[model samples]
Target: MRLSLISSIRRPGFRVRPLLGFWHRWFGLFAALWLALMAITGSAVVYYEELGSWLNPDLRQVEVINPALPPETWLGAAKAEYP
Candidate 1:
């Protein structure tokens, strides 16, 4: 079966050439457009974080405070605030 398939491909006839040509033309025609779209989407995904930070600079640039304060401090703060 493999031999027959390979032989048929190698033989090259009107049928195979036209079929291959049609597929080649169609795929080639769409390849550039598909690649451009893929490139744009890929770049967007890669720079998503940077883009988000650019849009919301304040939120992204805020300082991160240490939350390792003593338990007593937390309890006192919570009680003072809630009570």
Candidate 2:
């Protein structure tokens, strides 16, 4: 006698509630995972600058300068790099 898995699953007394329950559990897990991912990314976007500063401890503070650099000087440097 050969035992077939399909035959057992197709038995007339087998109930579908268990299969539905299994799928329901899986769907709930996926939905929760997707929501969690979205929430994490959304929070990161909302706190982008804060997150960057937190990640880079060194950049959180700068040495005090008596005089700030001129805007023209900053613009020149940016143009030099980008152009």
Task: State TM-scores per candidate.
Answer: 0.44, 0.48
Query: Which regions of candidate 1 are displaced past 4 Å?
Result: 1-16, 58-83
Q: Which ten residues in a row have the lowest lDDT in candidate 2?
A: 1-10
Error of 2 at 54 (Å): 2.7
TM-score of 2: 0.48
Regions of model 2 farther than 4 Å from truth:
1-11, 57-83
RMSD (Å) of each candidate, 1 decimal: 8.0, 9.4
- Please write out the lDDT profile of model 1 over residues 1-83, one tens digit for every residue: 99998787775544677889999999998998899999999999999999889988898665759767888999999999999
Whole-model lDDT per candidate: 0.87, 0.91
Model 1: which residue pairs collide?
Answer: none
Model 2 residue pairs with clashes: none
